[model samples]
Structure formats: C-alpha cells, structure tokens
Target: MANASNLVIFDIAANNITGPVPNNFGSLRNLKWLNLGFNPLGVNQQPNDLGFINSLVNCTSLCYLNINGNGLTGDLPSSIVNLSITMTELHMYGNHIYGKIPSEIVKLVNMTVLELAYNFLTGSIPDSIGELPNLGKLDLGSNNISGAIPTSISNITQLVALNLESNMLQGSIPTGLLNISTLEVLSLGDNNLGGVITEEIVGNSSQCVFLYLNQNFFSGPLPSNIGRLKHLVQLNVSNNKLTGDIPATLGDCVMLEELYMQGNLFEGEIPLSLKSLKSLALLDLSNNNVSGSIPGFIKGFHLIKFLNLSHNTLEGEVPKDGLFSNMSAFSVLGNSLLCGGIQALDLPRCQVKISRNKRKTFSLRIILLLVLLPLGSLFVCLAFIFYQYRKSKKMNGSVAVLHDQQFPRLSYQDLLLATNEFSPGNLIGEGKYGSVYKGLLESPTRTVAVKVLNVEVRGASKSFLAECETLRNIRHRNLIKIMTACSSTDFKGNDFKALVFEFLINGSLDNWLHPGPYQENERNLTLLQRLDISIDIAMGVDYLHHHSHTSIIHCVIKPSNILLDEEFVARVSDIGLARFSFFNTSNINQAQSSSTGVRGTVGYVPPGNF
Candidate 1:
C-alpha cells in the first residue's frame, strides 16, 4: 500500500481472489516480492490489456514477481521486457498470455527462473532467451510456440531443466546443449524435431534423470555413451527412426525405471546387461527389429511392472518367472518364433534339454546294463514300441481324413511357401488365436487367407477343431469358404496347424468403420453401403442358424468378424467360437444349453452368457 511505502513483502496466494489485478500496484516502490498466484484475478479483462505489468515497472526493487495460475487473458504486454533488471524470478505461466515473447525480456540479467509454460503463447522462441546469465530453469512446454529451437539456448550454462516439449518446434537438437552439466531433465518430446540424437545430448548430462525424445524423426544409432547418464530414471525414444543395436551400456543406468524404445528401427538382441537394472519397472521395445532369445534374466526383475517385446523378431523360450509370471503385464505378440512364457502368453512349449551331467550318468548306467543279460530284453521292448507308434500314426492319419472328407488337405510346407515363409510384409491381420497372412496357394493358384493356429493358446486347438467341423458341411453365399486345412509339423519339427480360406481383398469391416489417421486412402462407408453390409451379415447369420444341417450359432458376430469383398459384398468369418446344436431344431432363443461358458468377443457376447 502507498500508505506503507516501506512494505517489502506482499503475499496473497492460493486464495479464491477474483477480478482484475490492482492497476496501481507500482505505488509499492519498496516491494521486493509480490505473490498473487492461484487466483481468478484476470476475469473479463479487455483483450491485450496487460496494463498491470506496466504498473509493476515502478516497483524497481521487485526481485520476485509471481502472477501465475490466474485467469489472465490477452497478449503479454510489450512492457514485460522492461520489468525490473533486478528481477530474479518471473512466474507468469498458466495464464492466457498469447503473442511472441519480447526479446527485451533478456534485459533481466539477474533472472534465475523463467516459468512461462502451459500458456497460449505463439511465434518463435526469441534467440535472446539464451542471454540470461543466471537462468537455471526454462519451461516453455505445452504451448503453440513454433520455429526451430534456438541453438543459442546452449549459452545458458546454468540451465538445469529445459523443457521445450509439446510445441511446433522443428529441426535437429542443438549439439551445443551438451555444454550444460547441471541439466537434470531434458524433455523435447512431441515436437517435429528431426535428425540424429547426438551423443552429447545425454553423454555429458550425468545428473539428468528424465530424457524424453519420443515422437520425433530422430534417426541413427543411440549414442554409445548413452549410459553415461547414470542418474536417468526414465528414457523415452519411442516413435522415432532410431536404428542399430541398443547400446549394452544402458545397463549402467542402475537407477533407470522406465525405458521406451518402441516404434524404431533397432535390431539385434536386447542388451544382456539390461538385466542389471534393478530398479527398472517398465521396458517397451515394441515395433522394432530386435532379434535373438529374450534373456531369461528378464524374469529376475522383481520391480518390473510392464514389459513389451511385441512386434519383433525375438525367438526362443520366453522367461516365465517373476514379472514374466503376469501375462497381462508383458506382451510377446507378433514374434512367431518365441515360445513358452507364462501359460497366458499362448506361446509354444519350450523343448526340454537334458543337461550334460545327466547324460553322462545315463551313459554310465547303460554301460553296466550292457554287461548284464538285460540288453536282449531291452532291445526287444524298444522294437515293439517303435512298431506300435508307426501303426498309431497311420490310424491318426485316417481319422483326420474321415473327420473332414470335403476339406482338402495341405502340408505346412505348402502354406509356408505360399506365404513367403510367413513374412511380416505379407501379414494382413492379427487376432486372438493367431496372425493371418495373405498367401497364394498353388495348383488352383488362388489368393488365400492363412490363419495359423497357435497351439500354445489354451483354446486354440479347440477353436481349430470347431472351425474345421463347422466349415466342412456348410456352404452359404455370405459365409467364408474354407479352402483347406493344414495339420502337420513345421520345418522346425513343431506341430503346426492352419486354416486356409478365400482371401477377401477389401479387408475387414473394422477398418471401414474406424479409419486410422495414418490411412490416407481410407474412406468412410456411405449410408447405402452400410445398409447393404448389414443385410448381408443378417442373411449369413440366418443361414447359419436355420438352413445349416446343424443349427449353428455364430457366437462372435462383431464387426471385425465381418469381411468385405472387392465388390463390396459382406461375409461372416472367424467362426472359431461357433456352436453347433446337433438337434434338428430351427427355432432357438438363447445359446444352446451345451454352451457351458461365455463365448465370443467380450463386448459382443450375448447378455447372460457369462
């Protein structure tokens, strides 16, 4: 107050204070600190009326001024650049300030902390920002700021936390940033910045805890010295063009809790040393080219909560201990070579290997047995068992033919060759049971959809049996026609089962209903097209329920199960959960009493089925 001219400190924060900030606050000439944050103090002000900032100019002694978290509207007054040269902290963020930052603000040579984030500011960040000699923290995130990040920012050697994330900034990161040793958090995510992330970005910032460079065009290998940031707790480089092996030295970051490198071009085995990260809680390496076995040590991560190795070339048995015990917490999808994790992962069982020590003992026992009269009896018994196994195999072959006389038989080799060895490029869709590959079958030479059954899945074998039996005797215009089925071992000597069906060129109904942002050519279905598709689906269901030899219930009739042909004709597919009532009855209200449990996709499962 003017009456108390010697007033040095003014505090009025976190109160429900409303209306305009006083226009005559400059009278408090001796005021060194002014706090009026966390209030609705700028309601219904005239556009561009930041006159309060002008009044503060007379308070030359002001060292701390915080008007943040207010309802302030309009552009920051140009006079903001003329604030007291002695100003040490300027907290004017979380308001409705718009327009360019005035270059004259660099005049606050003594300013230490500049908080101007979460505002409506536009235009390029002024290059003069790097001139503040005492600045330590600079937060300008979650704003509409555009233009390249000024390379001069590196001049502020005292900077501790530099957050330019969630803006329209473009171009590569400035190599000059490496000059700041006090940097603790460098978040440049969700920007259009491109080019390689240089080694200096993190190699020098040993005190950095959080390094987020995701959602950019950063390419090339992660710097070899990335692990130099030993204090890093979270490192996110997802959704970038980064390639090459993940540096094994990452394990040196013992304090790391979250590591995200998904949607990149990384290859080779996951660094074995990563298991040394005792504090690691989350690791996401999805949508990369990572290969080799998932190390068993991953199971030892006691604090791990989320682990995703999906959409990679990883093979071998998945670890099934500790964090891996919870299938919901980790994913190994799209890695067909991977096998055996927790029961819920649905991967193939790992082949058991006898240790060398056990083999040596067995050989010693056999040597002694050979010196006795038991050798002759053992040979005879072995010969008899071999003969019986061959006879059983012959019988099983006949049984398979009898079960589906109409369905043509195919070998795993035949389908594998058709699909170019199940190449990832030919993959059309993925589902609960297994992935679908577009293939070209020989002889007739027609395109087909190959649904390989993952026998590791609990119900996959049952689904194969159900679909095979259902499709054998059924024929309808709107039903997917099963061309053949393959029940044989793969080249790897693993049991391989797949169903071959007529390939629908136009894909599933799911894409038509919800086109992704990346699908530039995708078009929304018209009203007439929607009506026709609905009618076709109804007709197919009608035939399955009433006209079929057995009253069949298509339990999973969701949109994804609906396929559209090139002519826009719809067909119902994925009858893995179909229920067949052998009883000759056309009328059926609820699912048959033989249906013991809930069947079909969660949301589409009929009410009361569960």
Candidate 2:
C-alpha cells in the first residue's frame, strides 16, 4: 500500500474489512480523498489506535477524509492540526476517539464540514471553530462535551446545520446562532440549556425546516411570532418547563408535519388557528393544562397518524370522524370532561341541553301538573323513608364491605397465614403504596394475590380506601375482581389493610411486554395475541370511564397495572389512584379538580400531573 504513491482517491467504505489501519497513507502525497468508514478497521489494538492520522499529515493534497464507524479507539491525535489546509470535510464520528478538540484545528482554513459525534470527546467546543469562514455543517452530538456552547459559533455565516444534542452542554442558547438565514436544521435537545427563548430567535430563523429543543430546562413561553418560520417541517419543544398559552400564530406554519409540545406547562385551549395545518401528520399535546373541546379540524387531516391529547382539561364530545375512528391512532385519556366518541373510548354520552325558552315553557307545565296531583307528595315521603333505611344499613364501619353476602369476611390473621407469615418467597410485586404477595387460601382452596398497604406511606391509607370504593360497585370481566378485604389490627396490634384478588397465572402485561431475565420463555407474543390483550385493556378502561355505576378514572393505566389470566384475558388492576366522577357532563371540570393532586407512576402519568 505504501508503494501506491500516485493514488489520489482511496475509497473502501461499508465493507467487512478488519484489523489496524495501515499507517503508510502519508506516502500517497497526491491523495485528495480517503474514505474508510463503516468498517471494523481498528478493533482491540488500543494504546493510540488513531496514530495513523499522524501519517495522513504528509498528504498535502488531501481535501476530504471519512473514517466513521470503524471501532477505532484512542485520543484524537493533536497532529490532526497538520492535515492539508485544503481539507473541506472531516468525518470521524461513531468511534472511540476521546480527548479535547485541538484548538489549533482552526489552521484548516478552508474546512467546511466537521462531524465528531457519538464519541467520548470531552471539554467545551473550541471558540475558534467559527474562524473557518466557509464551514457549513458542524455536528458534535452524543458526547460527553460539557460547558456553554461557544458564542463565537454565530460567526459562521454560511452555517446550514448545527447539531449539539445529547451532550452535557449547559447555559442558554446563543441568540446570534438564530440569525443565520442559511441555517435550516438546529437541534440542541437533551441538554441542560435553560432561559427564555426570545422572539428574535424564532422570528429570525425564517429558513429553519427542522428545530428540536425538547428535554431541556428551557422555561418561559415560546415566542408569539413562532409562525414566522413558515418553512418548518418538524418542531419539538416537549419535556421542558415552558409555560403560558400556546401561540395562536403557530397555525400559520402551513408546512408543519410533526409538532410535539407534550410535558410542558402550556395552558388554555388548543388554538383554533391550528385548523389550517392540513398537512399535519403527528401531533402530541398531552400532559398540559390545555382545555376546551377537541377541535373538529383534526378529523380533516387525512394524512394524520398519531395524536395524543391525554391528561388535559379538554371537554365536550370527542369527534368520532376521521382519525378519531381509529382507536390506535389517538388517545384522549385523563380528560374527565370529554365524552361521546366511538364505543371503544367508553366515555359517557354527550347530553343535549335545553334552550332557555324551552326550559321556561317546560317549567310552567310541570308547576301546573304538580298543583293537580296531591298524591305525588305521599309517594315522595315513601321513597325518602326507603332511602334512609338503606343509608342506615350502609353505616356499618369505616371499611365498606363489598358483596358481603357472597365473599367471606377476612382478618389480618387470615392474610398472614395465607401468605405464610409474609415470607419473602411469597412476594410478587412492590409499588410506592405497598407490596403484593402470592398466597393460598385453605377455605376455598384458591390462590390469590394479597396487596398489603404500607400505611406508613403518607397516602397509603387514602389509596386503600380509594381502591375499595372503586371496586365496590364496578364489575366487569376485564376488571380485576376483589374477593375480600381485611382492614383490621394485626397480631402485633398495628393497623393492617389488605385486599385479596383472584391470582392470574400469566402475570402482568408489563412482564409480557418487557420480560426479565428469568422470563426468557414469555417474551414472544403473536400479533393476534397482542391485539386481543390491547382490546381487553381498552374494554376494561372503557367500563371504568363509562359503564360503571360512577364514572371512574384509573389514574395509572400502564402496562404494570394490566394482568393476563390463564386464557390470556387482560384484567385491569391497581386502582389505588382511581378518582370517582359523580358530577354531570356540564360539571366535568369540577370533578377533575376534586382529586387531591396528580397521582400515578411517573412516565406513565401525564406531564401535567408533575
């Protein structure tokens, strides 16, 4: 290879080549381009595996070099500064190169593209990086690089794409970077950057097509003139501390295809102006304080794919047309005021309201009819007496007994014995409120899951009561059945509360979806089996939200809360955070606020809850 001194272009990428890269590349003085990417060129040969770069310095005519994804290990040699001054592009990402980027790299005066991402490179980016007058793209993402982004980067007038995501970089974004008219893609997500995103940053970036600012600590409202970037194709600002109403002008971005603003503090109704986004495909506004009815315009977007508006204050009827008809395409969960969708949603029916004029006319006729019937007063007294009698029977104790006639009353001792004195071997699952144990009952010769509340937890007792109340009157095949409950003092005289449920041999849906090491054989599920489980879960949630005696919201509806039976039937369990809605459709907002606070497991819970 050293004798090939006249070689001008050495191209061998994306091959199965392995072993150390030859260090004789400097012999090719006329080498103008070299490409060796996507090959295992440097595997375990450590101590300075990238020393071959030192030999490339002799190739004065080299203008382009690409050696990405070669499993190469070692610090980026400082000798790189001696590379050909004519070098315009250098691609060394997806390798094990570490150490600080040499500040003297500015010597490569004509360099344009520099990609060093997906490596272990540390230290802040050199301020001199902007000295390259012709540089266009710079990508240093997915590295351990820390400290503030260099403010000098804005000097690169010709910059088109800048990606610094997945780094340990801190501090607010530099305003000058947004002023470049040629800039199109700006991704700085998954960082510690914070502060208000100024209007100039949004309004000036009129040519930006893809912008990502998600998973950061950026606070304050977005610029009201965000719609100035009419060329935007995708915009993501999710998982931030941003607050205030979503700007109405955002609808002017007619070219937008994907917009994500979930996990933020944005409030008020989803702006009607968004109806103009006919090309939108994916839209997520979940976990916010957004209110009002879901806009009907969403149904007109024929190209729409996924839409999640869960955990919001949205009210009124959910549209049943277009994307709404496909249950898999969208989710409106946690919106207590929402009703009237497809049967699969299980929301209460939307009631028609009487007009003011019609109400007055009806009242006059009712008053006249009452005056003609004195016997109506007698029947009212009889109904009141019957109601009082039932109320008296229900005041037995603090622990409300459910189906007492069918299930036997259980005590603390009964559960202790059933679970073999709460042995570690009997334990099955554990959660924030309590632990669950697998046990056997002698009387019925049945196996069961015993959920024992840890009353020491601040809200354990309340959760216990809530679970009992939710399960007391609701009965559905897809819902877990409570055989009996024990709210008595233990043998040691401490308060003990436990709920007994029929044990499902197949375990939780979480286990089935993401099996542990011990569950190797339980990992695979056919597409049909998965569909059946999904339908079963949807049916269970529908019953809670619509068909039950009272409207119930299973505050936590994650995979862990779903169980599979012997026949693979899904059963929704863990109603410890369930909230009851007794108010009519018109008072849905009041019902939603009646809960003490946002409750549920993190990640699974809506962002608004946090």
Candidate 3:
C-alpha cells in the first residue's frame, strides 16, 4: 500500500465503477490528477469518505483533482486557495456540496474543466467565474445559482460547453456570452429570462447540438436565422409568446430531430419547407392559427412518430399518414371544418346515386326511338315531381307543428284572456331576466304554466330558433320542457313572440332550498333528496367536463340555475355561460366559432379571466 504514494492521480468516471470512494485516497502524496466522475461509485455513487476529503491538502502537489462522480457531501472549505493553486481540471460534479461557493474559487487561474454541477450549491455565482482564462467547460447546472450570468463570461473564448440550466438565474440573457465562437453546448433553459430572443442567442452554433428554450417568457417573432444551426438535433422553443410565421429558414436545419413549437402565437400556414427535415421524429405545432389543409403528401414521411396540430384554424381532410393511421387523442381538436378521419366522430358524407329510370330512358333513346316510351317517361317524371312536392309540404307541416307546439305558445291576447289582463293575482315570480306569470292554455288541450318576458318584450322579433336549438341540445329532467315557440305580428303589424314551456308543479329548486314562506312546502325536502340533487348536479358537470373529449367549466354555478322535477330529481340548468378552457380566443371574430374570454355570471369568475 506504500506504493499508493507514487500514484499521482486516479480516475474512474463515465464508467460502472461501484462502492465507496476509498478513504485511503487521502494517502496519495504526489497525486496531481484524481478523477472519479461519471462512475457509479459509493451509495448511489455518494460516499462517507467525503468528510476526510479536506485532508487531501497534505498532497501539496495535487493540481488536476477530480472528485466528481462519487457522492461527496458538506460545505466546500472556505480556505481552498492554498490547496488548489495549480489546479486545472477540478471536477466535483454529482456531489452533495452545500453553502455558497467561496468567492476565492477565482484564484484557480489554470482551471480548465471546473464542473461543480448537479450539486447542492446555492447563492449567487461569483462574477469572478469569468476570470478563468482556460475554462473550456464550466458546468454549474441543476443548482440553485441565482443572479445574472456575469457578462465577463464572454471573455472565455475557448469555452466549449457552458451549461447553467435549471437554476434561479434571472435578468435578460447576456448577449455578450453568445458572441463566443467556441461554445458548442449552451443550455440556459427554464429560467426567469423574459424578453425577445435576440439573434445572438448562441453566436457560433455550427457545433451546437441541443438548445432547449422551452417554457420561457420569450416574446416576438421566431428568428428566421434559426437555419444556421445545421447541427441542432433537438430545438424546443414551445410554450412561449413567439408570434408570426415559422421561419422558412428552419428547413436549413437538415439534421433536426425533434421540433416542438406548440403553445405559441405563430400564425400562417404550415411551411412546406418543413418537409426538408428528413430526420425529424416529433413535430408539435398545436395551439396556433396555422390554417389550410394538412398536407396530403405527409404520407411520404414514414419516420414521423408524433405529430400534434390540434387547436388551430386548420380545416379540410386530416392527413392520413404516419401517426394518423391509428386513432390518437393527441391529434385534431378545435377545427370546425375538419372531417373524415375515423368513426369516433360521426362525420356526415353526401351520397349520390343514378336513378334506374333515367338510365333506362337514356338506353332506350340510343336503341329504340319509340314515341310511346317517351310519353310514358314524361308522365313518370310528372308523377315524381308531384310526389316530391307533397313530401316537401308534409315535412314543412311537421316543422310548423314543432314550431307552434310549446303549450301551443301564447300571444298577448291568449294570456290576457287566461289571466284577465295582467292582474296581480296572476303573477308567479319576478327576477332579473324578466317576470313570470301563471297562465292556463285554453281549448282542446289545456295545461298550467308560468308566462315570462312581459307582452312588450315578447312583442319583439325573438330569436327563439337559436334558443330552441341550444335548449334541445341539453337533456335534464329538472329543466322545463320547451314545448314550442309562437311567432306572429301584433295589432300594429310588429313582431310578437313567446316560447311555451312545460311548468313543474313544484317550481325551481332555488325557491325550495331558499324557502320562501308563500310556498312553504319546500322545507319538506329530506336529506336523501338533497344528496340525490347534489349527485345529479355533480354528474351533469362531469358530463360537461370529462364525458365529452373537452372539459367545460360551468362558470355561472349557483342555486338559481338548479331546478327540481316532480320526482325530486335535482336538475342543473342554465348553461348560458359555460366556458371551454382550451378554446382559442382569436377565432371569436370568425362566425359561429367558440368563445374564449372572461365569461359567466357576476359572482363566479376565477382570478385569471380567460
């Protein structure tokens, strides 16, 4: 073991070496380079021998020291100057070092590979870091280092890899550092740097491999010069505020592997130049306004594994290539005109068929030029026309019957005759959205119900068609059935309208739960009934949320929107202000599109409005 003194250095990094870093390492006298990084040594490569590592100072000749891979712990000695004056390759990565890195570290002038990354190092990185003239690879990533990246870091012209990612660093990205010609690996992602990503994000990208700027606050158009990084394997700039068209120059990155540009404000069509990326495996450009048909020629690319173009203004036939062959939830949503991908979405298709009679007549014209056949064909055509006309009239009658069907709906005169002309005795309830009146439908069939929206309001041209469309789409037992709408001109030739609805004997659950004395029977609701009502409401909300592919938030949730049926089933109603979380706001100007904004009744808006 005495021969260990002659051993100047020991290294076992980037290997499968295991167990504790031998405490006997302290005995090495002439040790100049002791490297054990990238190796699976010690407990999870952590070591108890770290406490004795300070004793290495006895080996005054030690210069190129590397105790990186094995688990070393505790604070760096505050007085490390005397032991590392000639140190050039000081690698202590994958360690448990804590407390602020002493400012005295700047004294190591000859340091080349100073790797203290993946440690418990905290506090601001010393500005003196830029003083190391020979620092080729300065890795302090996955730490709690805060403060601006010192501008002086640009002075290290020989630096090849400067990784300070996943730190607490803030402030605009230092433009000067990007000017360095030799830096090939620069990762500063997941920080508080907010601003436009300037052109000099990484100056010499000829050798750059991976550049991840995802989940940052960078705004403005994506740089057109991104093509300069010909060797960039993975470029993820997703979840930013970058606007405008994706630069065509990105096609210059022929060696690109995965391109993630989702969740940005990028507009315009998907660039055809993107097809030039031969090696790309994943391409995500969702949540944007890239309109136009998905390229049919995408089938040519067989290497694509994941392609997400959802929540965009894209329309027409979805591409049936690569990942599209299988029904994937990751593909296609928020596109209004997209159709014909799978049976999951019941898309309609038009069918055209040639009639046998027409075909036979055309054949007869070529073979037998007979007058009898021509006369018979004319009669048949006339008969077909009459039959079609009658069928159309019947369908129109059915629609009309459906239209005037709601309690056969009431006019100002019908309600006046039923209620003796708005007497206070006929009033049922009154609230914001209008008043309600209890009236009976007379004649062959008579039913009792409330009349709402007074004669003046009802006399206007009402959009009952749209209201009926929205109402019939929902099916809840608690909601009153919209029987039909009545539309006609009043005595002054002005439009007067009303919608007749089936009235529940017990009325709204709101009056029941709130207990008004005039209708005192509401307090009779049992605990079981209340529980059943709560369950029904929750189920309704759940259906609006998960059962459908997209989740919907019932923004105006309150007691008034809840109604009780004759069976005491709690029915949630009035989804007038429900908001979809993933809806795109920019498309609101488009006709018949979704709304994504501050919505809901006055009392229920969350902190972040839309």
Candidate 4:
C-alpha cells in the first residue's frame, strides 16, 4: 500500500464493500479525493471502526470527502478539524451519527459545501460556522439541532443556501440574515422559533428565490418591502401568528408562482394588486378574517389553478368565469354570506332588473290593463270557488301520506332518546333549515345523524318534505343513505320533523379543507387523496343527473354538502333543494326556466338569462 503514496484520487462509491475500512490510508500522502460512499461497510460500522478518517487527515492534498447514505453510527470524528487546508466539500448525510459538531470545524477555512442533514446530531449550531469565508451551502435540516441561530452567520458573505428546517431551534431569526444579499434559499420551517418579523428582515435579499418560514410563531405583518425579492419563486409563511393586512406590494413579485398564507390572523379585503401576479398557480388564504367580495378581475388570471378562500368573512357574488368555473379546483365554504356563481356552487341567485324602453312603457301598460280587466274578474270568481272546495276537502281529513313511504317507522321519541334528548352538546352541525345531532341507537347498534327541522322558520317544513321525497327515490354508494323520517309531536306539543341518516364520523369536506383551531393541524389531503374524493363526488352527481328513476338536479353542490365516512369516501348530501325533472331535454329546460327564485344556497346559481 506504501507504493500508492502518490495516488491523487480514490473512487470506490456505491459498491457493496463490507468489513472495517483499512487504517493505513495515510500512506497515500498525495491523495486529493476519497469517495467511499454508499457501501455496506460505511453503513454498518462499529464506533471504533472509522479509524480510517483519522488516517486520511495526514493527506495534505485531500480536498473532497463523501460518505453519505451510509447509515453509519457513532460521533463525527473530532480529527475532522485537522483535514487538509485545501478541503472544500464534505457530505456525510443520512446516517445515525450523533453528538455535537466540534467548534474546531472553523479550521476548514476553504470549505464550500457542508451537508450534515438527516442525522441524529444534536446541540446548537456552533457560532464558528460563520468563520468559513467561502462556504456557499450549509444544510443541517431534519436533525435534532436546537437553540437560536448564531448572529455571526451573517459574516458568511459568499453563502448561497442555508437550510435548518424541522429542528427544535427557538427565538426570532437574526436580523443580520437580511444583509446576506447572496442568499438564494433559506428554509426554517417546522421549528419552535417565535417573535415578530420586522420590516427590515426581508427589505433586502434581492437574490432570494425560495423562502419557507411556515409552522412557526412569527407574528405581525409581512414586510411592506417584500416585493424587493425580484427573484422569489415560492413563499410559504402559513401556520403562524401573523396579523394585519397582507401587503399589496406582494403584487410586485411578478415571478412568484405559489403563495401560502393560510392559518393566520390577516384581515381586510384581498389586495386588488394581487391580480398582477401573472405567474401565480396556487393561492391559499383560508382560515383568516378577509372580507369583501371576490374580485371579478380574478377571472382574468392567466395561470391560477388552485385557490382556497374558505373559513373567511368574504361575501357578495363569486366569479364564474376562468378558474372559478371548476368547483373541484377551488373552495369557498364557511362563508355563509357569499352568493351567486356557477350552478355547481349551489349559491342563491342575484336579482336581475327588467330593462324597458321608457318612452313606450306607459302606453304598453295602459293597453294591457284595459284588455285584462274583464278577464281578471272572471278568473278571480273561479279561483274563489276552487278555494272553497279545497278547504272543505281538507276539513274532512286525509291519511298521513309522508308516513306511508317505504322507510323505517321512527317516531319523535325514538330520535329524542337516540340523540340524548336533543341536547345542544349532541349537535354536530347547523344549517339554514335545521340542526344535525350525533346520536346512537341501541337496537341497530350503530351511530346516526339526526337532522331535526326548525319548523318555526317559514320554509323549514317544505325543506323536510323535499329531502324525504328526494332521499326515498335515489340509491348510490356516494349518496347519503336515509334511515327514516320522524313526523311526530315533541314534548312541548310542537310539530317535530326530523330525518335520520347513516352517521359519517369524519364530518364534511368543508371542515377538512379549512380546519378550525380545534381540528388537526397537520391533517392534509395529498394529491391522490384529493383525486379520489373528486371522482367519488362526480360519480354521485352523475347518478343523480342520469341514472336515477327520475332525473334530479342537486340544487346545491358545495363542500359542506359533501360528507366523509371513516374511510374518507365522499358522499353527496343535503338534498333539500333537489328537484325532479323529466329526462327529455325540453322538459329539463322548462323545469329550470319556470323556477322563479334560487333554490340552492347563495354563490352557486347557474348562469344565463333565466
């Protein structure tokens, strides 16, 4: 082996070599590179087996060292501080190595790339790390590193990337980091860091392209000068304590493609200037206090694909053109005040005015009035006779038609007992027509949701009848199953009308898309999960529209109307507005046209003159 003392490079990587490494490698005095990475020997070595690293320190010309993905155990050898002065790169990630980094690492003055991520390393990052004048990238992410980042890191003027994400680091970011104009990526997500992000923190850094500060405790508004980062492509500051209005200057980031600011305290209307972000593809502003109408100009976005505005105070009409046309790609639930969009949104319709020619309107009215006077008198006389006949028939009484339907004979007492006497604590959700309570039935040994109607409202009884009529005739795996309907009197002798359904423990899609404070913070649907849910919803709607015994139009089809069972399978529910129609094209159009006012919730009426 002494004959190889003049060797300048050794490249044995990704081979299945095993057994302890040789310790006489120092004989290769002129060795400049050693790449013994991705080998079983490196991955499964004893604590005293890495003595080769000590031997390599005598190789004055060694400049590069890579032993990553080796699953090696034991502390980083302290002799690393005695590496060659020309050493510039070191990669030792994806291992079981523990213990604090030796502060003497500062001796590697020429180091440029140092990656120690995905390991068991603990303790605070040593402050001397900044003494490496030419270091360009420093990654310590996904480790047990803790404590505040040393302020001296600002001294690394040549650094281009710094990642310390998924650590136990605490305290605010050092203000000096803003002065590093060469930094292109800085990730500090999933940490315990807290404190305000002042204006100066992001007022500089013109070259930054990606910034992630999510899952922290940072508060206050984003710096007004945030637009200064002309190269930024993605920015995420979600799950924080940030407050105040979003800076309109964000529009200045013309190159920005994604922005996540959900789960914050931001208020005020979405800045109109955001319309200038021509490159934006995803925008999440859910779980905030944003108000006002969704801007019509949003329809002009050239590339927006995903948007979430749920759990906010937004109101007025939802835009139907452009991205808003796809209900599966966006959400507007939890905004009870919103109205008027595509029919799929199931929102109430906005009133339209009749535009008439003022000059001929008066003459036209007079002409019609004179011609209809005699006909009106005869029509009224016949209507009075028909009313008297109907009154007499009603007084004679009739059989209970609602109870004769093919459903379980559930009485009011059964429901009351199942839902713990309809206690408020048993209530799970509330809607315009009624309150839904979670209940347990002993005979069936199953859980159920009991929707008890608020008959005191003007149209509550009609809604109950509509739901019963619709549920009894439809059957689909993706549609809510009706167990029974109760129409008996309550203890107070008031009219009691309720519907029992198969209980879905996971609640509605609305809650999952916009979780409140009490909901799981880390629960999120992946792309595959979302696609499956979308397919389920589409199949359910398809059956209602075409395969049912009678064609049915689901008047409202929002997230709140979609329930999820234990397996997360979607089910279309809330059929109070469903209307049966003929399968014939002409009859379908006639049915839609004759409907006077909106039948669905606000923000979801179909478009057209009707």
Candidate topping lDDT: 2
lDDT per residue as tens, model 4, 1-610: 7988889999899888875788888889999998878887654558865567899888999899987877777787899999998999999888777888899999999999999999989999999998999999999999999999998899999999999999999999998796798898999999999898887778588878899999999998888899898778899999999999989999888679999999999999999988778688889999999999998777767588889999999998899888888887789999989989899989988765556685479789889999999899999999999999964653333222245546667777888899999999999999887899999998868899999888798777667766776778789999999888877677888888888999998889988888888875656887756866886898798788777877777777898899999999999998776766665634566554211133777776454322
Candidate 2 per-residue lDDT, tens place, 579-609, comes to 6678763354456532324378777864544
Candidate 2, superposed: residue stretches over 4 Å from native: 359-610
Please give the lDDT score at residue 19 for candidate 4.
52
Pairs of residues clashing in candidate 2:
none
By lDDT, is 2 or 3 better?
2
Write candidate 3's Cα lDDT for 1-610 as tens digits.
3677888767666787775655565578778887776665555524343555666666667787776766766676664555656777777788777778777778878888888888888888788888888899988888888887788888888888888887888776777776676666777777766688777865555657677777777899887778888668888888878899989889878778889999999998888888777677888999887888887655555677877888899877765445567665337777777877666645544234679999998898866657677888999999999999975664333132234333354565775666556577877666433455566777745555443443354311122333344444555454445665555555777544455566555667777778777763547677657766776676677565544344455666677767666787766654434555454333423223222232445765643444
C-alpha lDDT (0 to 100) for residue 270 of candidate 4 = 93
Task: Give the per-residue lDDT of model 1 (tens digit) for 35-83.
Answer: 9999888777567446788999999999998988886888878888788
Worst ten in a row by lDDT for model 4: 394-403
Cα RMSD of all models vs. native, in order, equals: 25.2, 20.5, 23.7, 22.7
lDDT per prediction?
A: 0.84, 0.87, 0.67, 0.84
Name the best candidate (by TM-score): 2
Selected candidate, larger TM-score, 1 vs 2? 2
How well does candidate 4 score on lDDT at residue 13? Answer: 91
Report, for all candidates in order, the number of backbone clashes: 0, 0, 9, 11
